[model samples]
Target: MLDPKTGLPPRFLRTPDAARFLGISIRTLEKHRTYGTGPTYRKIGGRIVYTLDDLQGWTENGVRRSTSDETPCRVFPARPLTPAEKATL
Candidate 1:
C-alpha cells in the first residue's frame, strides 16, 4: 500500500516485482509502459522502475457521478487564447 504519510516515492520495483505486487503478468506492465497507458514509472538506464505508491494510487476508490450527470469535456491545444476571448483582458 502507498504510505501517504511519508509522501516519499515507494521503493522502486523491477518489472517482475511490480507485476507480482499487482498480481499481473510482467508482459502486461511492459506493454502499457511502452504505450503510456499504465501506472507511472521511471526508466533507469535500460530498466523500468515502478513505485509502490503508483500501484496503490491505481486502486484508489472514489465514486464518479453517473453518466447522466457527466459533463462533456472539451480539449484544446496548448496555445494563446483566441483574440475574441483575450479582448476581456
Candidate 2:
C-alpha cells in the first residue's frame, strides 16, 4: 500500500505505476502478467498489485548495465572536414 505521510508513491503499485517503475511498456507488463513470467504480484480483490521489493528484484535481474561512466556520448563538428583541412595534419 502507498504511504501518504512518507511522500513515497507506494509499496504496492497498480499496473501502470509498476510498468513505469520497471522501465517497460504497459503492453509488455500485461504480457508478463498474463504469462506469469515477471516478478511476484497479487490479485487483491480482483485487481492486480505489486510490491516495491518485487519490482526492485525484477529490475536487478533484467537490467542492462549502463556504460555512461566508461564512455559518454559527445557531439561531433557539424561541418565536414575538407581536403585542405586534411592536408594540415
Candidate 3:
C-alpha cells in the first residue's frame, strides 16, 4: 500500500517484504545481512528495515551492459569475502 504522505510505498520495509521486493528468498537476504553484503538497513525499535532507495542502490551495483563489462562496485554473494576480494573492495 502507498504511504499517504509520499504517495509511494512505505518508506521502510521489513526483512520478508524487502526480500520479496528484490526477488530473492528471505534466507538469502538474511545471509546477505549476516555477511554485510546486502542493501543498507536500519534497526528501529530492535527491528530491521530497509529503504527502497537503499535496496535499489545495492542492486544497481550489479548492473552491467555486457558479460565482460566492469562495474564501479559489486554485489557479492551471501558469504564471507576472501582476503583478495576484500582487498579489492
Number of the predicted model whose lDDT against the real structure is largest: 3
Quote the positional error of residue 84 for candidate 3 in Å: 4.1
What does candidate 2's lDDT look like per residue over 1-89, in tens digits? 44769987676889998988877777778877665567678989999999989878865553445643332211112234468954653
lDDT of 3 by residue, 26-47 (tens): 9999999998889999999999
Q: What digit string (tens of lDDT, one per residue) describes model 1 on residues 2-43?
A: 549897655888889898987778887776666555677888
* TM-score for predicted model 1 compared with the true structure: 0.54
Minimal lDDT window, size 10, model 3: 69-78
Question: TM-score of each candidate?
Answer: 0.54, 0.59, 0.83
Quality of model 1 by C-alpha lDDT: 0.64
> Model 3: clashing residue pairs?
none
RMSD to the hidden true structure, all candidates = 10.4, 14.2, 2.7
For candidate 2, the lDDT comes to 0.68
State the lDDT at 14 in candidate 1. 85
Q: Deviation in angstroms for 71 in model 1?
A: 12
